[model samples]
Target: MAQLFTPLTLRGITLKNRIVISPMCQYSAEDGFTNDWHLVHLGSRAVGGAALILLEATAVSAEGRITPDDLGIWKDEHVPGLRRITDFLKAHGAVAGIQLAHAGRKASHSSPWKGGAVVPASEGGWTTVSPSAVPFTENEPAPHELTLAEIQQIIEDFRVATRLSLEAGFQVIELHGAHGYLLHEFFSPLSNRRTDQYGGSFENRVRLLLEVTEVTRAEWPTELPLIVRISATDWTEGGWTPAESVQLAKLLKDRGVDLIDCSTGGNVPAAQIPVGPGYQVQFAEQVKREASIPTGAVGLITDARQAEDIIASGQADVVLLARESLRDPYFPLHAAFELGVDVAWPPQYERAKPRRR
Candidate 1:
C-alpha cells in the first residue's frame, strides 16, 4: 500500500488519507463573512479527496485580519456562514480545519492583487500593532507596540474564536504562529525588541504563543487535535533559527499540541530563501525527529512520488498541498492512481476516473 494513502489519526480525529489541502487565502470576502464562493472553493477540494481541508488565516479579531477582506470569527454572527462551508466540506468526506491568526504589524494592507502596499487609517486600514514598534520592511511605518493589557485581550480573542470554531463545526484548529504574524513577531528577536517578560530571551520570546495555545486549548475540545504552524527559521542570520524551532516544537508538544505544520522563512521579506521542491520538508523531518512529534511537510511538494516518499520514508506524517491542489482539485485522487493505490472516487465522478490495467 502507498504510504501517502495511509490513514493518520491525531488525538481522536482520524484522517482518511495523508493528503491535506493547506490553507490558501482566497482574498474574496466581505467584512469577514463567507459566502457561496467559499463554499464552492473549499467544498470542491473535499470532493477532490483530501483528508483535511484547512481554511485560510481566519482572524480571531477584526483587526487580526491580514486585510479588510480576510475571513473573521470575531463575531458570533459569522458562525452561521462558516457552518455552511464546514457542512459542505464534511458532507463531501473532508475534515474541516481553520487557522486562527492575527497579522499584527503586517496588518492594514491592500490585497496582493491591489499591489499589497500599506493602507493608511484614512483608507479603511487601522493602526497596526505588534510586540514591538517594528514594521515588516524597514521603510514601512512602525506599528504601535502592544501594551500588556492589549496582549491579554489577544488571548481572550483566541479563546472566544476557539469556542466559535466549535459552534461552526470545524474539526481541527491550527494556531497561526508562523509567517511572521503576531505570534511569530513576539518570538523572533528580529521583530521583537521588548525587555518585558514577553520578550528578551527564548523563553520570554515564545511566551505569547504558549499562552495563546494554553488559553485556546482550554476552550478547544480535548478530543480534537491542535496544530501550530511555525516558520521554523527566519532564513536570515541572527533571526529565528531551525534549532530554535525544534525547541519551540518540543514545548508545544508538551502543551498538548498534536502536530507541527512545518514551513519556513516568512519573517523577513527580503531574506533569500532556497526555494525548490522538497526544500522545506527537511525542516519538518528535523522537528519530527528532535521534538518527538508528528509533522506535516509543505512547500513545492507537487508530485505523487515525492509525497509518497515523504510519508513512506517517515520524513513527515502528512503532505499538504497548496498551489498544486489549486491547479488540480483532485490531485489526491490522481495521485492514488499514479501510486497504484486503489482509493474510492466520489460516486458522482467515479465514471471519469482512469481505469486500472
Candidate 2:
C-alpha cells in the first residue's frame, strides 16, 4: 500500500488516510453560529476521501471572533449545528476535528472579501484583548492587555470548548496557537511586551498556550487526540523561531498534544516568508525529528505526488490541504486514483469514479 493510504493511529484514533482537510475560514456565520454552508463545505471533503476534516478556527468567546462572521462554539446553542457537520463527516469516513481559537488583537476584522482590515468599535467590533496591549499594526487600535483573571478565564473557555467539541462528536481538537492570533501573539516578542508571568521570557511567553493545553487535556477525553498548530518561525528577527518551536513542541507533547502542525509567519506584518510549494514542510520535518512528535505539513501542497512524497520521505505524518481542497473538494479521491491507492469511494459516487488501473 502507498504510504499516503496507510492509516495513522494517534491516541487511539485511526485516520483512514494521511490526507487532512485543513481548516479554512468561510466567514459566513452569524453570531458565531454554523449553518448549512458548514455542513456542505466540510461534508464534501469527507466524502472526497480526506482522513480528517478539521473545522475552521472556532472562537471560544464572542469577542474572540476573527470577524463578525467567524464561526463560534462559545455557547451551547452552537453545538447542534456543529454536531450536524461532524456527524456528516464521520458518516462519510473522516475523523471530525475542530480548531478552537481566540483571535486576540486580530479579532473583529473585516472578512478577507471585505479587504481584511480591522473594524472600528463604532462599526460593531469589540475591544480586542491580548497578552499585551499591542496593536497588530500601527493603524489598528491597541488591544487591552489581558488581566491575570482574564487569562484564567480564557483557559477555562478553551476547556469548555473542548468539552463542547467532544459532545459534538469531534474526535480531534487542534488549538489555534499559530498565525499571530491570540496564542501566537503571546509567543512572539514583537507583539508580546510585558513583565507579567504570562510574558517576558520564553517560558512566560508560552505560558498561556501551555496552560490552555493542560486545561484542554483535562477536559478532552484521554483516548482522543489533541493537536496544536504553531508558527514555527515568525520569519522576522527577534520573532519566534523554528528552534523555539521545537522546544515548545516538546513541551506540548509532554502536556499531551499529539501533533505539532507546523506553519510559519503571520505574527508580524513585515516578516518575510518564503512561500512556495511545500515551503512549510521543512518546519514539520524539523519538529517531527527534533521534537520527536508527529507533525502535519500544510501550505501550497496541492498535488498527489507532492503529498505522497511528503509521507514517503517521512517529512510529515499528515498532509493538510487548504486552497487546493477549495479548488477541488474531491482532490483526495482523485489523488487516490492517480497515486494507485485504492481508497473506496462512497457507493453513491462509485459509478462516477474513474476506471480502475
Q: What is the C-alpha RMSD of each candidate to the true structure, in Å?
A: 0.7, 0.9
As a TM-score, model 1 comes out at 0.99
* Per-candidate local distance difference test: 0.94, 0.92
**Per-residue lDDT tens digits of candidate 2, residues 229-277?**
9999999988899999999999999999999999898888888788899
- Number of backbone collisions per candidate: 0, 0
Per-model TM values vs. the true structure:
0.99, 0.99
- Which residues of candidate 1, in runs, are more than 4 Å off? none
What's the distance in Å from true for residue 69, model 1?
A: 0.9
Give residue 30's lDDT in candidate 1 (0 to 100): 82
Give lDDT for model 2.
0.92
